[model samples]
Target chain A: MEHILTAFGDILFHPTVLLFLVFGVVVGLIVGALPGLNDTITLAVLIPITFAMDPKYAFMLLVGVYTSACYGGSIPAILLKIPGTASSVVTTLDGYPMTQRGESGKAIGISTTSSVFGGLSSSLVLMFLAPILASYALKFGPPEYFALAILGLSTVAGMSGDNVLKSLIVCVIGLIISTVGMSPQTGYPRYTFGNDYLLEGLPFVPMLIGLFGVTSVFEVAEGLKSRVKDGTFAKMTVPRIGKVLPDLAMVKRLLPTWITSSAIGNLIGVIPGAGMIMAIYMAYDQAIRANKDKKFGTGVPEGIAAPEAANNAVVASSMVPLMSLGVPGNSTSALFLGALMIQGLRPGPSLFQDAPEVAYIIIVGFFVANLIMGPVGILIAKFLSGIIFRIPRETLTAAIALLCVTGAFAVGNSIFNVWIMLIFGILGYVFNKLKLPHSPLILAVILGSMMERGLYQSMVLSKGSLMIFLTRPISLVMLAASVFFAGAPLFSMARNRLKKRAKRGAIS
Target chain B: MKTWKVDIILAAALIVISVVSFSDSRNYPDIASHFPVRLSIVLGILALVLLVKSLIKRREEAMFTLTGEQFRVIVVVVAAVALYTTLLGHLGYLSSSFLLMIGMMTILGFRKKTVMVVTALCTVAVVYAAFNLILGVPLPQDFFMAK
Candidate 1:
């Protein structure tokens, strides 16, 4: 506790770190406000900037970016009817409607409040819980990591949209792509096609940019051609700060949704590959199911609170695996681990013991970033909200295209990476057009490599015995949870079908 | 062609990739081949299932076909990238990148000649500043470096 407080004091007093945090927040907000630009892209671009800075300052910057980007995404979603990131998709349902009604200000305000609240609540949890969780996570062996990977892959089934089979296929394809490098166990190359670049395997950031950014750009272009010119954008009013805060009744209504969704988010986030998007969607679904009187997708406070709280909560909990076991839960956290590596810090049990101050600083920094996000979000909301809406479609598309191209190229400084990005872009477009979920594909890709590595290591360690996963209590519990979660949709679908048939019989 | 045709084409491509990947796995030892071989097999199975489903269903839906103009734009962009890659070793990063950006902007229908020139120049300058000055990462200088 003393160490944590001292770390906090140091971070507060450090001018350089504070400046980087503010700069990161500003950059993150701008990137997140821009339609088609996401937190991943922002982080990727900022990575170049971080190459020269100290790891502690660099990570502080990234933490700021990560926290604020979530808040920034809601701005465009509220104003432009376009989600800045996949996790913000639910925000658009009510956010856009509010914009159309000329209540853009009110919508932005509520979004800002909820976003800050969600982020702060999660950061607090992270500050208190991460150290304790790290202690437990230190006990995990290869078997536990392998089980966790399987649990991560299981999320693909849950996030497969409507078609579980198609999602599985995409997941399989992703797993294949993940295997396209040198084998960890034997040091033998697999599927490298004699290319030197392939020996290092497919880079994740470039793949993500192609999958999310470039593909979305194509879709945006398509939509631009058909979209009606609604001059309703010009006259949109920004709501005052007072009007945006939820009334007493609204707060009461949203409290359960917020708490429940945050809990769900934290739980799911502890499991690898269950990302913020899934957390947000599941929270939204739960909130809607629970609300009997209020119709969701109608600017209801609970609808906003549920997803916002859930996504943000997942942000902190996603760090549990990364900090404890040196296994990243999601892409952002994976990048965070990479940043730690670049700083010569190996994230494991030893990190807490060796550099308790650094660990505590990062945990406390989350709390500070969250607190800063609220006021920053409100101050910038009115100015940025209007300006972003006014950005010409042509310029927006071109700038994004350029960013995607350069960002993808910069990932590894290889033209082959550029080609890969373009290929994934087309693949992403095809998946989007076909109503196939890309989340499962991405999650599979990320987890697939780790799963293979973990499984092989565990097998070698245990002398080919498959019983290791069952023998480890932590691994066993995670695997059981994965099975239960995977089975949930089937039961729900069955019940829904049965209800529909009964309704039809009653009508007859 | 219908959406199912696209699905069939994708399935066929998957099968080919999987087969090639499986064959390539032969060089690796048992432990090394384990993951890739398993992945290839799973991919093959999935592709086969997709092929069978496509054949059985024969479902037709309006495919989101690209317009000829859109097709032309994409082709030009790809061609520009190819040109950039092919010339990179010989022409160097700065010259090749500038040419690529200009060509892409023109192909994408940015009509103003000045806009194209400005965009190309600014892109190269900014990228150069970022890589060379800021990050201090070396770029391919080709013949100039030897001199």
Candidate 2:
């Protein structure tokens, strides 16, 4: 505790850290405000910038971006019907409706307040929980770690959302993509296509930029041709700071939702493959189900609070895996891990003892980032909302394309990477056009490599017995949950059909 | 013409990819082939499912079709990237990057000569200053390295 306080004081006093935090917030806001720009892409692009800074400051920048981007996404979602990021998709339900009702100010105000609350609460939890979890995680061996990885894979079934078959297909594809690089256990190349550049495998950052950024540009360009011409800009009026406080009734209503969602978020976050978006959506679903009388998606504060809290909570808890086990739970966290590696710091159980001050600084930085997001979000909301909407669509598309191309090339200074980006961009576009969910594909891509690595390692350890997964307690539990997740939807559909048939028979 | 056609195409692509991947996996030892073989099997199964489903449900849903203008815009952007790749080794990172940005901006209908030149110069200067000078990361040198 004393060390933590000292670390907090150090971070507070460090001029470099403060500057990085401010820079991160600004960059995060820009990325989050722009449609199709996401936290992962922002982190990936800013990675090259971090090579010059101290690792502590570099991580501070990433933490700030992660927190602020969540808040920044709400700006566009409130002002425009379009969600700036996937997590903000639900925010659009009431956010845009509030805008259309000429209360964009109130909506943005509430969103800012709720986002800060969620972020701060989660950050506090992260600061306290990470070290404890790391200590416990130290006890894990190869078998335990393998079981945990399988547990994480099981979440893919739940995340697939009404499409088990498609999700499984996506998971398989992701595994394939992950195997493209050299086999880690053995030094043999797997799918290098006879090119020396391919020996290093597909770069994560370029592929991510292509999937999220470049594909987004094409989608936006398609939308631009027949653009919705609603020129009504709401008069910007921020609610007084005092007015942003939660009332007794509001607090009482939101407390359960916040607690429940945050817990769910943290649990899902610790498991790789189930990202914040999934955590948020699952929490939202649970909240709605539990509070059946309350009409969600109708500007209810609880509705907003649940997902906001859950997503932000996941942001911190997602670090649990990365810090404890050296496995990144999501793309943004993966980038953070990359930054840590670049700084000559390896993340695993020993990090807590070996570098307690750095860990403390990161935890403290998360808190500071959450605190900064509220005021910055409110200050920039009105100015940015209008400016972003008015930016010529053609120019935005062109800039995005340019950024994507440059970013792809810069990943490894390989032109081949640029080609990969284009290939993925086209795949993304086609998937979008076909109304197929790209999240599963993206998630599959991210997890695919890890899954292959884990499965191979486990098989080697178990001497080729596929029953190893079932024999392990943790893996068995996770597999059981996956079965439940997969079966529950089918059961629900069947039940609904039977009810409809019964009603029709009664009428006859 | 139908949803089945799209499904067939995707399925065929998946099949080809799986087959190629399986044959390729044979080169690696058994330890390495384990994961790829499993993945190929999964891919083959998914392709079969998709093909069957597409055949079963032949009706097409209304889809968003891109206009010629939009297609042209995308084509120009793609071409700009291709041009950048072709020229980067020869012209170097800074010069090639500048040309790519200017070419893309122009292709996207930014006709102001001053704006184009300014945007090009500023982008190159900033990117160069940030990546090269501040970060100490080396950029592609092209003929400049020889000099």
Candidate 3:
């Protein structure tokens, strides 16, 4: 307790750290409000640059970005029909309608209030939950770790958008890609093909930048022709800005919805691969079920508040698995893991034991970032509305592309990393074309080696007996849960199909 | 091509990749080979399942087909970036990045000559300042700067 309080004090009192945190919030808001940029892409581009700063300051910046970007995504979602981030897709259901009805101010205000409430609520959850999970996870053995890896990999089913088979294939491919470096148990390189660079495995940070940042640039380029055709840049209009805060009565009415949706968001956030999109959708669904009087999709405050709160709630809670189990809950948290690795701070229980200050600072950073995200995000949205839209799309695209290259190169001072970024960028573009989910590939890359190491180590420990995994209680339970999660999507699909067939038969 | 056709091609390609990967992993010791060996089999099986599903279902919707302009833009962007990366070694970070930004702005259809030039230069300068000067990353130097 004393150590945590001291860490918090140090983070809050330190001028430079506080400045970076504020700077990150401001940057996060601006970038998030933009159409193409999101928390993942921005973090991917920023993580390499953070290598120069102290880990504490670096995390302050990143945590600030992570917390605010989710909220910032709601800005464009409310003002324009375009969702700034994928997580804000549901926000557009009601947000844009509010804009058309001249309630844009009220909508933005509700979004801001709900986002702050959600973020702070989940930060508390993350603060309390992560440390306890980490301590409990301290007792995990090789089998348990392998089971945990399985549990992580099982999330591909959830992340798979429409096609479970495609997601599985991508996950397998990612696992195979992860095998490119040396075998952990034996020092023998597996798939290096005599390349020395492959001995260190794939460059993680560059790959992330490629997968997120470069891919986004390619997507932006692809969308340019349509934007031009639709006069997106030619004749953009700025809507009127009015009152920015929700009334006390409105806040009281939204209090239950905020609490319910935030709880849903936190729950989904902690579950690996069930990311912000699911949180928002689930929250929106819950709102629809709860409010029969309110017509959703026609600009209801509950509608905007539900998804806004839920998405922001996801920002902090997603870090729970990363902080506790060293398994990133989603793509954004995976990037955070990459950042931590770059700073030479391995996550999990040992981090708390070895460097409690850094751990606590990160936790406290989330709290502080969330507390300030409300004001900072609102200020940027209120004041910079004109400027945000005025920045030429071409410039943003070029800048992002350049940043991707610079970030990739900066990681190792090698042009080879840049090439890796390009390759993955192209691959990412291809994956998007094929409707394959990037999250499965990312999760696979991060967890693949861990799984292999655990499998082999447990084999050695038990004299090559596979029963070792089944014998351990925690491992057995985890493996069971993994199987259940992995199969759930397929089972649900089959059930839906059967119901459809039955309905057709009855109709006929 | 139809989406099913694309899926079929993708499935076949994946199967081939798994086969090659499996064959490549065959020479490694058991400890080194087990994971990939198993993973390759799983990938092959998954691909085969996809192939079968695509063949059976024959979903006829178009895949994410790109329009000509969009395709042209994407191709130019990729080619330009590839060129930019290649140039980064010889031309240095600042020059290569500046050229890349200009090319990107042009390809993205920014017609304002002055804005494009200024934006490109400013972006490169900011990158160079942040990465090379402030962060001390050893960004590639031009011949003159190197001297």
Best by DockQ: 3
Docking class of 1: acceptable
B6-120 in candidate 2: lDDT tens per residue?
6678788888988898889877897778888878987998989988987887858634566677776667666677777778778888778778777766665556788777767
Query: C-alpha displacement of A387 in model 2, angstroms?
Result: 3.3
Q: In order, what lDDT does every prediction score?
A: 0.70, 0.69, 0.81
lDDT score at residue B7, model 1, on the 0-100 scale = 77
In angstroms, the error of model 2 at A277 is: 8.8
The clash numbers for all candidates, in the given order, read: 1, 0, 0
Instruction: Please give the RMSD of candidate 3 to the true structure.
Output: 7.2
Query: What is the two-chain DockQ of model 2?
Result: 0.33
Minimal lDDT window, size 10, model 2 chain A: A228-237
A1-508, model 3: which lDDT tens digit per residue?
Answer: 7866887797788999998899889878865665445678779888999999998889998998888887787886776554556677668768878976867778888999999999988888888887564345445778887887787677567435357888889989999999998888788898888989889899876786677667778887888877988867655455566788998999999999999999988876776665676567667756765775687778999999999999988888888888888888888999999998898889776778878888889888888888788777777777654454457778877887887788788778889898998898889889989888776787678778878888988998999899999999989998997788677767877888999999999999
Task: List residue ranges in candidate 1 displaced over 4 A.
Answer: A1-24, A27-115, A220-363, A377-388, A494-508, B84-105, B114-147
TM-score winner between candidates 2 and 3:
2
Instruction: In candidate 1, list every pair of residues with a backbone clash.
Output: A105-A239
Candidates 1 and 3, the one with greater lDDT? 3
Kindly give the stretch of ten consecutive residues in candidate 3 chain A with the minimal lDDT sum: A131-140
For B5-72, candidate 1 gives per-residue lDDT tens digits of: 87788789889988988888856898888887887888899888988988898879865666665555
Once model 2 is optimally superposed onto the true structure by TM-score, how far is the C-alpha of residue A495 displaced, in angstroms? 3.4
The TM-score leader among the candidates is 1
Give per-residue CA lDDT, model 2, range A241-264, as digits (tens): 224446677678778887887787
Judged by DockQ cut-offs, the docking class of candidate 3 is: medium
